[model samples]
Target: MTPAPGGFTDETFAAFLKGRDEPSWLADRRRSAFGRFKATPLPTLRDEEWRRTDLRALKLDQFAPPAPAEPSEAARAALEPAYRGLDSLYGTGIALVDGHAARSPDPSKLGGAVFVDLASAVQEHGELLKDLLMTEAFRDDADAFAALHAACWTGGALLYVPKGVKVETPLFHLVGLSAEGGADLSHTLVVLEEGAEATLVQETIGLDRGKAPGLHVGGVELILRRGSRLRFVNIQNWDTSTWHLSRERAVVGPDAALQWTVGGLGSRLAKVNQEVALVGRGARAQVNGVMFPTGRQNLTYITRQDHVAPNTTSDLLYKGGLKDRSRLVWRGMIKVEPDAQHTDAYQKNDNLVLDADARADSIPGLEIEANEVRCTHGATAGPVDPEMVFYARSRGVDEATATRLIVEGFFANVYDRISVEPVREALALAVAQKLELGSAPTLASAEAAGV
Candidate 1:
């Protein structure tokens, strides 16, 4: 079957995949995902998840697939106008400029590691990719954007650590969106064999500071072999006018643990699907997510903790704050299969509303087929405690100051889960700055001092 004019087609996408030298299995999967993308209509309000998000004005047809690495000086300069010093903890650094990996920075000085751009690796490491790329081990479902990403992704990163290797430093990947009427499709695959441990940092940003609106669609798959550990953080600070969608999931082998933290502070409309399956006994998964929305922006976050094996545990905590006319919806679920005995799962979603005009929705559910399993799910959506705000204002704090205090306290729960102190401080300062609460000199000093 063919896609609509100007829309992506399986034939074109399949040809592109074949040109990348990908294995026949991956190419076939891309074709199948493309067919699904063509058959499944664009989500509208009629759908449960898309009810709060309006995509009519997005005009996704205008975005052309990104070209190969031939960026103009202007585009190159847009990459890093003010160089952010490289992190000493992350040995390898990769930059996805426009929609391709611009250059391969040296990462050999570090320990045993494999880091390469997806497009480049397709040509250089086709065999290894076929054996370790996006497998059905991660998740079996894909939405529209995920299907599109599978079909048309041009750039991303791949990191692999062999067994018995420990990476002290994280792997840093930067995905940049710079061109107008262009789409950024990136696919990140991280694999850690048994006895391997590593951390990954993913940053998505827009080079266009103007009002131009573009599309960022990405898919990531994480595989953790037995006795491995992985920590992943997604720092999304794109242009406020952009529309972004991402689908990421992980598969845990026996005795493996995965920790994920996400901070969403940009984009006019965003949808994120984060899930993980505990396929092995004693596997653990934890997720801590925080989002603050202002203006007319709207954000949707969905998370799933599926236990297919016995004695697995998963915990999730997601917090959100909305001001102005913005809105946010958070839906989470924890499912235990029939034979998954002794599985423990917990899910909680809390939202603090700062403005009367703003809105927040929370839906938390659980499905347990085993009688001996332990599962609990809860959701809370409401305004800040009026008594607490009044007490602060009664002690000489202005209305705005008191309001910011309440908001900060609301976010403290999720921010504390992040082990990286510098990023946490930076995020807190950024959140305060966005709320226009710069009057709090203490916040600036704390952030500057990296306390």
Candidate 2:
């Protein structure tokens, strides 16, 4: 196998895996993944998917694999509120700090279900993990970052709900980073058996305020069996000094339903690819996302909806607000198979430019091979309307207040559609904070301020 570029190499990966007592099959899989990572080149601006985002300034050699560090009192204290709020709203909570499982759900609450650290899951449910892990959602050859994640992933969570079981309360998973100049590669696997139902909320946060940049490459695989239902929400809030890249995919079985939501509000640079495949007849999926990029952040998102069987359906909507010199890119595609008759799919993306220097790009596409399918896609990018501000000001509203109201209304269409109350409220607050810090004053600013 060829040697890996930068500071990552086969020897480095082998040493990292040593003494872990991992199953031989998993060890071989990692070695194979490392070979793929070595052969795959880092993406460049010339690549079609990477055309809008540039990573020439990044130095991968400077980042080293994460080493377990004692969680600091201050770091734990700072994250207390996040954990408390999640636990209060959701009945189950799991916290991983610095790629270590810091907190997990009790066995009594989990019952026959499996909710534990990845390492433990490997020992307890090796057969299940081996069969589903990295099998479909994330492939070794998907991309350079994905290949690297497959070889270097360390701490993660596994959630498995058995057949006919239904979890009434929601579950929360938190992945946090505190070590500087280190990298955290995590994996999350969620499986719901036939007739099962569950709700999962996941969040990634950076707890350290370090000057040096850190790295986070993560992957998520979701599998739903026949007639299963899953509601998933993911919130990303990494520190400004971190670079985040992730890939997520879900496969829905016959008559299964999935509701997936995502919020992006952190990281210096983030590129995420999220996809869902309706592989069984009558499967359905709904994907929604909201992002707020400020300062010099660069955020790119790619989504795919694949209808593989007849009578499948999918709907997707994404909204973003950009400020300062930040840039946002969204690429979405919907594909219907030749046999997928009566398929229904729709995708839309909207961007709100909050600053003159900010930029937004939206691309939507559809690939259909079936004649009896209905598919539609649309994208829009523009600044907030000044006339709306004027109309609000005419109603005796202050300039700042009017701009805030308009911005809020612009996002309310998406936010109000989120089914989870806590997640919706939290994301709304995040957007408000970004607007307060980065939103440019409207035409009413000068007149209202008596300038």
Candidate 3:
């Protein structure tokens, strides 16, 4: 009902709001965010965070907010291994079709947890939503995308686990976008109270690929209270023609532990910002990332680890592979506040380029104001080792198979750090499929690589 020519203009923004059925508070928030979006300009190559990234070809006006979509079996079927085996891993799940929620868990199955679409949470859990949504974990109008997402986001999910509730089964959020799903502006908010524990898996799939180009501007906020533990895995697998942009942040509280894993393998151009803030003593975070880009795609990740409390610890590892004309970029930082003494942080990013035309860029940094902190970072980018391929070929594997095997070995380390069996399998199988391998990586290859 909205999103005409000049998709993001003030006129279209007002039209978008006119079509939504939201409350006064939400309307006010949208207006404020749109105001900020108008005041802020889109990132350019001149900005520090975007110096290596360019958006000169992106025309936001060409994309419209996705209209509510009907679930299609054909679309789901097209996702193959990425969407496969999901039903067996979760006790309950939320499915979003073309930026609209298709199904939600029965409230009784939540076991005292609140897993519902953000649209409903705004009414059923307004007070808590008001206090936490965009207030704690990812609060900022840093750029145009952030503000635009806050202003026009829809078809998102919220998971709020009560204090002391330990959900043994992982929860799933799956999104399927089709050719007709013009634009996806979804926000995911996950909140775990004190002593609570849960696992949440978020996945995005491009159903009916090679249709019209698409756009996704997404946000994710993870909030863990004291002593809580959370495991979150994000799978981003949109079509190569889509423009994918996202911001994600996690706030870890005292004695809480967070494990975040990511799989990025799709999109024409992606620019993501991921950050973690340790706000309490004894807090810990372990982050793992795996990215494989093929074709002419461009992928970039900007990550930060913020130590805000004493005795906080953080560890991060990211692995990437580039093929064809694809390019990958990683810029990472570890920041230790003056008050956060005894902080321990480490970050590393490694990339493998498989083609002469492909490129990879890795940049790691540290900003420490604390005298008693240990922060370290490392990065590496290069073509695959020729000797490894030669060895594989000497062992009777074909050159192509050998290359795939070596690439598998390259990602084995990060995969080992992932605790979820299904997630690990899905990411591995998805990446393998992208490399033209079958459903699962070869066991011989796994053993040869010592995975």
**Measured by TM-score, how close is model 2 to the native structure?**
0.93
| Per-residue accuracy of model 3 over 1-451 as CA lDDT, tens digit each | 2235667877778877887777788889989998998899899999999987889988888876554334465654543333334544567777776666666776666788999988778878888888888988765498999999988888789999999998888888887667666788888999999999999888876766575777899999999999999999987877777899999999999999999998888888999999999999999999999998988889999999999999999999999988888889999999999999999999999998888999999989999999998888999988878998899888899998988888888999999999987777667776777677322232112222334
Q: How much lDDT does candidate 3 score?
A: 0.83
Candidate 1, superposed: residue stretches over 4 Å from native: 1-5, 9-29, 81-83, 86-91, 103-105, 137-141, 437-451
The segments of candidate 3 whose C-alpha lies over 4 angstroms from its true place after superposition are 1-3, 67-85, 437-451
What is the C-alpha local distance difference test score of candidate 2?
Answer: 0.83
Provide the lowest-lDDT 10-residue window in model 2: 439-448
Q: What's the count of clashing pairs in each model shown?
A: 0, 0, 0
Listed in order, each prediction's TM-score against the native is: 0.90, 0.93, 0.93
Worst lDDT run of 10 residues, candidate 3, spans 438-447
